[model samples]
Target chain A: MNDQPAASGTPASGGVRIAVDAMGGDHGPAEIVPGALDHAGAHPEDQVLLIGLEAAIRAAAGTLPPNATIVPASQVIEMHEHPALALREKRDASILVASDLVRRGEADALITAGHTGAAMAAAILRIGRLPGVDRPALAVQMIRTGAPFVLLDIGANPDSTAENLAQYARMGAIFAERVLGIPEPRVALLSIGEEKGKGDLRIQRATELLDASGLRFVGNVEGKDVTGDLADVVVTDAVTGNVVLKFFEGLSTFIFDLFRDEFRRSLRGRLAYLLLRPGIARIRDVFDYEKAGGSPLLGVRGAVIITHGRAKRRMIAFGLGVAAETARTGVPALIEEALREDAARLDAAGAGAEGRAEETTLDPEDTP
Target chain B: MNDQPAASGTPASGGVRIAVDAMGGDHGPAEIVPGALDHAGAHPEDQVLLIGLEAAIRAAAGTLPPNATIVPASQVIEMHEHPALALREKRDASILVASDLVRRGEADALITAGHTGAAMAAAILRIGRLPGVDRPALAVQMIRTGAPFVLLDIGANPDSTAENLAQYARMGAIFAERVLGIPEPRVALLSIGEEKGKGDLRIQRATELLDASGLRFVGNVEGKDVTGDLADVVVTDAVTGNVVLKFFEGLSTFIFDLFRDEFRRSLRGRLAYLLLRPGIARIRDVFDYEKAGGSPLLGVRGAVIITHGRAKRRMIAFGLGVAAETARTGVPALIEEALREDAARLDAAGAGAEGRAEETTLDPEDTP
Candidate 1:
């Protein structure tokens, strides 16, 4: 259902084509369509392919801009469904169609505020991974501390090995350097303590690999240090990374709730809140995941952006913008080259694991 | 050296005898002595045995109160030293002396803001563990969101087995019920997701064990939900818990910094900050770890409260208060009884590991 005048853009040369899953997020096409339209309007040279049901897209979008096209997909995958099974059953699902567009070079990048598991599945199964990359990690840029930093494998590759973590450090570093414009990005392995011998078995091993890898390895940084300016890119297995990410997100919300309670407690607090409302708004803007423009599914062959399922129109628009910028910068290609250059060293490190295992002992102790 | 006035208090009534490690924290006796004295002053019936270098303790405390006594110790363990090595070398360390006092029933509880590793080592090597407890877990109560919730094994056992987590849940639940006063506390496995099979192998296995352990098992709670009112006791391996605990601590500091920056950004912001300063102060009070007292080292034979290395006067008093309360409730004995009763079921679950291994698949995917 590619019923579109696809080549309508009168660009002289370079332009990005982004595929957005219109029926993916909680608000579906109602939120996504307007966001896609806004992106298309802003970047007239770039094409925004809104992939979903044709009627819903048109209804939500009203009149689409010249650069935006409605590429129809008949099915929608619900949030709670098992990703793999749903992808297999719903062959024409919106996320699948969006990923296929990127895979086939019809779109330069794919953006979705969909079921995260489904998005990751589609990115891996349809768009594929870079050579020598064992897994495609999701990297999120955190602006919580004013100085933006990237944390990787947020919810991908739960059972990551030391090699995977080392690889994540490399990829995250490149993203920080090339996309975020941080020079010689200080890379750190997220662990329980700052000491080299701290953390779990895998973390201890990863620390050694990172130290030897020749990146700006900052040894180990704890969760407390992540929100500081200590490291530009932090790498960890998906479980710890996911938990930390969610905790930050949830705690910010909880903090705001606390403020609300405090403000409503008395008349003085209420007046104070009135005076402090703008400052609170700025704080909210800083912590808002939407302002970060979603996370990039790193190590994939194509640019795949995954925003929150609760994303609104503005968030969707920002996510699409990130997708366009990532595709324009050719981050995936750079990552492939970086990995290829470091392959021999990583191989030697893996082979030397047994020798290194004898060097460090796993002693359980309190870190405080 | 025990000195002379060990049993000076005349009244033959119920009163807790607490051994305080005066040379434990960053401030040493300078901070700890005042706090212990304050506790002794507040609770005149209870006795506080100040254990440290006699000269330093005397200098820190010019005059001891009637209920407080100086128990001399000749050594102090630096924070950076290895616990096992330090304990072997400094046999008469303040922490060691405190632990020995508790072991010999001279003191009903032990409190230290010293090297956490040393405190844990002293507690285990001197005071010993409760019967059937494989590892002693450190449980910290968080009051960031107004509701207090306990997260366990913060930095005790990094490589925890499924059985260890199950044991932590049992211990944490008992602490919540008896000490925190939460009735029939809801216990949850700290994981990446809320689903049954959402975490790493051990956490997934622990989920099953907790389900059948006869407690109010609430399945799994993610890091995001830990700050909320979802669960009273959240159990995990030390690595995750340590990172989360530090993250919460560090982020709270970073957030206040953010507020400071916002306040300094403009004239209006500075005025607004003045008006809202009291509310912000209340927020600080909520997130203050010192206000929660020290973390309890559960599963040990005696009441051992481990405070921060940076503990000051008020924090030390709060920690002693916690230690007194914990000893008064006989938490360790209660934990022993609970474990003895549930030993059969836990043993059965351990044996069923092989059969359950085939039931769940470890899939690497995003969990948004």
Candidate 2:
């Protein structure tokens, strides 16, 4: 594990290296091997280190590309296992081993289609969090009405304070700027309504902090605004964000299934579906989660993408590409700088607004 | 205003009567008059009492049905006007007038497509709350995959406590049973995950309360489960519920618009559209908000419906139908009885479980 010297304080360069958890996803090596091969073929300059049991990797991959290699790990974390507990118990787990490669400068980034909680746990526990960052957040890039934006804290911290929300705004804004290429991203707090005092106390306090933080604060936005281009980056506690993301995924699938069933109901419908096939395909492409790659777990020292558990070869391949691209852009370093700058600004402001800061802090008496 | 003697709470004999706020919606009397006429025409025995300026009502309605009559009000509440302030100042506003009709039993129920805030204010201030009911909730009946479910506190109470959510569960369960015909409705708390300790403290506390409330509690259901057949009644604070509802509405509209634009792009696509017209129409019918009628503001002494501000004639007619059906079934009376029973149970439990009751109470320190 310590064969290569750790890359300290500098971003990986020359060519990108991605550590993929080949045994982590629902389909295991069967899906992960092909996905890794696909990525290696498409991105000739990038290398994929497939981490899993040697026998399973060989059984699935058969013949690997020149740029792809297998790194053996004896244990695997199941989807339903408690993330932190499992990570601590199985030190040589595929996800942990993949994260270790990133930590030791053997790989530039880590990619997995495994348990989301486990992926976040491994990334934070193995690779570590950026300095001054209290918690890492999962940033998802969503498209609505042909407009793309980022939403953060999708499932990392279930109970987040106003401070965590403010930090998410900063991290999400940076991700949108560096990855999504939105200049001076407009950050919005996801609340019940657009009014300032619409949501609960946590939201109200977060709104105030965001307004005073000098970001392009766009006031409060509702769930409808997530797909309305109302903001470039939307921030919320993990609970609400996770629910919204899942709901979007479920509803999208439900609608498509309904359409498919309708098209097969009659001969006339079948003919219509044939003619409309290409157009419908294009519409599906616009909403395709696979094409969007994976959601990046931000605030970690290394780039880690937590792909959907139901992801196939296409989604897995796209996830590896995303990992390579994120590493190339040095997004983690950029996020670290942004957070430091934000913290310094808050420190200066806090000197004069101590009362406001104390008012917004999490209260112990609030716990039930 | 009192030309006819007030028919005290005897459920509007012969046929149900609905007080319509003709001047309250975006389209004013133009939309409301025809909707009233439609309802009156459909149900000959039922009566429509249209409240608005006399001239405008006559101009828009032309000739009303035999059962439809204009009950003129001198003022109207604009959609943007402050709900409580305007209701106090404009005592004769159409919304207020309609509420008065329901309160005095001139009409069995109140129907309005006006400002939602205004409508809720008028209902609570004029019609009053049911006995043992602390907060009223707006319950929306949603359909997905041809399955219907009731969601409560959609916009009535934005900041809700555990006790309030517990009450919403009871109210929503009764609504599902009486109106939606779901006997022994399964109630679920809207949360980020299905895990017991998933969301914030408020949600966790609410889960405990619901479990002990003696209903068919189905534990916690995520946002993805809303459109699924996981539960009959999904209860949440108004903020989250409103966001989910609006997002569903916006996303549905956005997807259909995409399909429409896609079909019009080329000749082949257009041909496909023609053949798929009927199938697509059927799909649209499944997600049609207008067909669902208005969401009921439960926990009030009288039946009150808050229809969408953008509702048209057909939607208004359906809303009136909902009002008549609710009155006929005595939903308000049923809700009152359920609430009294729940209150009694809580009171008995509170004596021995004072610590638990105090822990569940809304903490003042939580308010920022």
Using lDDT, give the best candidate's number.
1
Q: True contacts preserved, each candidate?
A: 0.46, 0.50
Q: For candidate 2, what is the lDDT? A: 0.80
TM-score of 1: 0.91
- What are the candidates' individual DockQ scores? 0.39, 0.31
Best by TM-score: 1
Q: Ten consecutive residues with minimal summed lDDT in candidate 1 chain B? A: B1-10
Q: Per-residue lDDT for B365 in model 1?
A: 48
Instruction: Please estimate how well model 1 matches the true structure, expressed as its whole-model Cα lDDT.
Output: 0.82
Interface RMSD of each: 5.2, 9.6
Query: Which 10-residue window in model 1 chain A sums to the lowest lDDT?
Result: A3-12
lDDT of 2 at B48: 89
Off by over 4 Å in 1: A1-13, A264-267, A347-355, A358-368, B1-13, B263-274, B347-368
Point out the worst 10-residue segment of candidate 2 chain B by lDDT. B359-368
> How many clashes does each candidate structure show, in the order listed?
1, 0
Per-chain TM-score, chain A, candidate 2? 0.90
Cα DockQ of the candidate 1 complex = 0.39
